[model samples]
Target: MMLTKEEERALSGEYGEALSQAMRILVKVGEVLGAERLVPISHAHASGVSYATIGEPGVHWLESLVKGGAKVSVYSTVNPIGFDPYSDIIKVDENFVKGQIRILEAFEKMGFDTSLTCTPYYLREPKPFERLAWGESSAVIYANTVLGAFTNREGGPVAVAAAIAGKIYEAGLQVLENRRTDSRIRLGFRPTDAAEWSAVGYAIGERIGQGIPRLEVPPPPRDHLKYMLAASAASGGLAMMVIEGVTPPKTYLLGEEEKVEIGREDVEHMFGSVEDADLVFHGCPHASLKELVELDNLIKEKVEKEVWVAVAPRLYERANDVIKSLSKKGVKFVRGTCLVVSPIDKMGIRKVATTSAKTYFYLKRRGLDVWLVRLRDVASA
Candidate 1:
């Protein structure tokens, strides 16, 4: 991979051992991916922060970087952990807490904002055409597809390395020519809500694999777009897609290839029948302020089952009054963690009812049964 004079110095250990190692990692990754050069990034978000997902080996890897004096050279944020640090909302074992604490400390030492959320865009919104090295799947898709920013779905360590070096390999979604839409997918029926949009995304992913699709659909709600992106990432490993009106037109080139049509019936088959669930979860990508408010309004009535909703630390702090009111109605607001990474099964939550296909997708991987429904339906059920 080609590098600037400053980048060469970083690789040659002029900056320090940690930075040199980070530079080396980027160089090797660039070479393997056929990147022509390194590009400076404006922001980064590191994943694999949860002990439930990354365990002792991940902790060791991060702490070793910290011991080598690694620190973020750019604005960086962290993903969710296994549980809430300040509350008993996610009830995991003491051992789990201990391990998660070490991971949190390591990130803190590295100068990362411990937001503990998958939606880093909520913390610092990226501008169109801005370069980012984000690791969280949902965030990467949102950056590339929604905000028109440039980033591929980075791995945990690679994102951290980019954070320290403030640079990433110029390849994948960073190049404008690479982000062209290869196919046309038209929605036969409009999605009614976020859950339906999520289901549509799941169906699309299953059908089109990694194809760069341009969707011809109605203007979905903002929250629905979040669910759509997360579900697409979960089911298809999709890094980016083009929405009809949302995505910037100039960012990606359109092509006339195979035309795929998706209808409501197709999405209906993907959803299983809803039954009584042990728990109800929301916020796989972490709830936005608007989502929290909507959820709070929905659950003003009595709750029959245990419900958990996770949000970013900033949202948790800013919406304290609203959160406290929701807590009174039996809605537990989980901070620093979401249902995807948390050990909810250990807490006797084997069956989950959720409004997110992304949540359903991840939970199914853990041998948990999920019932997919709209947010209002979940609230009323």
Candidate 2:
């Protein structure tokens, strides 16, 4: 792979050991992926922040980068951590809290925004054709498909490296020619809400298995589209998709695609009954402010069940009025964390009811019986 003089110097250790290591990692990754050269990126979002997911080794790696003088060269953000530091409702081991705090400090020392969200696009909306080095499967696919940005599904360390170097290996979705899709899906039914859209996305992912597809359905609301993209990425590792009027023209191509029809029945099986759920949760990708307001409106009376909603800290702060109103109605708003990465099992939450397929997928893998419900039903579940 070819490198500019500055890149070469950085790789050779003239730019400090931390930057040299970061450059080496990017160069090695690019070479392995057949990237011809490194390209500049506008932004980066690193995942793997949850202490429950990465444990001590991840913490050590981040601390090592901080010790080596690593600092971000571009605007960068981070994914959700293990749990909300301010929430007293959710309980976990003291050791876990300490580990989470160490990880947070490392990110802060390295100049990352520490947004603590899977949906960094909500924090900083990328323009069309903007290049990003982002982790978190859902965010990668959303940036590529919905926002018309260029980014592959980056790993946690790779994204952090890209932030430090301000460059990424130009391969995968970064190259326009590779964005062409030869698979098409026709949706016979319009999804009513986020949960149904999530089910449709899960079904599409199950069928396509990482293959990008052109959707024939009308563009749903942005909030619903968010859940669909998140579910597809979670289930199928999908990085991009083309929706006729939604995805920006010239950013994607449709070939002689094999057509498949998807209807209501196809996604019916994806929704599970919410009868015995110990906890009702929402916001796997973290709820947007609009969604929070909608949740507030949907619950007409105080909820009888334990209801938890996850949201980005920034959004949570902005929705103070909505949060207080919902709080009176028995809604607990958890900032900067979600059920997927938090130690809910340790908190005695066995069966979960959520409106997100991505949450359903991860929690079920952790031995909890997860149920998929509609957005309106979540408040009452």
Candidate 3:
């Protein structure tokens, strides 16, 4: 493999042992995936270092890294840490406040510009033509497809590795060949809304697994496109997949034109039912403020037994006032937690409902009755 002087320098322990070690791994990831070279990223986000998400081990590691006084070579924002309104669950009880504060202090000391939001693309936009290696799966899809930025769904460790190395692959999504549509699946329904894209993305994900698909569907059904991709990724273990028509693949159609059949039954099998749903989850891939504002209205009309909605940190604070007004109703607005990863069953929650096909499958896997319903119906019910 060839190396730029900076790459060779970074590999030679010029950036410290941890960063050097991180670069080696990123190089390996690049090699395995056949990436040509590491591209510079203007802005990036790292996931899985959340104190709340990974529990004790994660928290301890952050503390240690902070104390070690490591340096991050590039500018990056990050997912949430500790308790915030965006997350429904916060790991305050697990860690000593002193330790938690120390970790934050260390990040500050190390000059890591951290913003406690998972969906950093919402916070700070990554422009088209800029290449980034981001961790959070939904964020990667949003950047790749919606914003036309280039990124792969690099995992948490890899994001750290890339950040340390100050580079990630300039190839993959950056290249024309890899970005071309590999297969095609015409949708049965035309999604007139972007929210429904999550379902369509999920349905196609079920059919094609992790491969790219030229999805011919309208962008309707609701709000938030990443929800569908997240649902698909969660069910199928696909970190990142492409929607050819919607993403940056407009001119191309499945590379020489090939047709693939997706059985309605196959897409339907990934979901259960939403008939008597007891819970509604908004943040599979983290809901935007638009979804939260919509949920606020849904709260008034819902008037159900118990409905909890999670939003991003910034959005959660805004919804807090609205939540107070709906005290009489069975609606609760929370954040920093999601139904797919949180403990809903312990809350005496059986029978769940979601517009997200992703959450429906996860809930069903946990032995709960899950209904895959539309968001409009979910708000009314």
Q: Highest TM-score: which candidate? A: 2
The lDDT for every candidate, in the order shown, is 0.85, 0.90, 0.62
Model 3 ranges with Cα > 4 A deviation: 50-57, 80-114, 192-196, 219-224, 237-245, 248-254, 262-275, 297-302, 318-330, 346-348
Q: How do the residues 1-381 of candidate 3 rate in per-residue lDDT, one tens digit apiece?
A: 567888878777786666666668777878887876777777667777444356566556655655544567788766655444333333344344444455556556556665656677776777766778787766776676666777778777677667656688655665655666666776665554333556666666666676555556554332456776666666554544445345654422246446776545545544444456666555666677676556667554445545555556565556566656554455565555466555557668787777677776677788988766555655665
Arrange candidates, best TM-score first: 2, 1, 3
Clashing pairs in 2: none
List CA RMSD, all candidates. 1.5, 1.1, 3.8
Question: What would the TM-scores of all predictions be?
Answer: 0.96, 0.98, 0.81
lDDT of 2: 0.90
Candidate 3 scores a C-alpha RMSD against the true structure in Å of: 3.8
304-377 per-residue lDDT for model 1 (tens digits): 67777778878889988888877777777788888888888888778888878888888888899886877776
Give the best candidate by lDDT: 2
Clashing pairs in 1: none
The candidates, ranked best first by lDDT, are 2, 1, 3
**Candidate 1 segments exceeding 4 Å error:** 272-275
Model 2 stretches astray by more than 4 angstroms: none
Q: Could you tell which candidate, 2 or 3, scores higher by TM-score?
A: 2
Q: lDDT of candidate 1?
A: 0.85
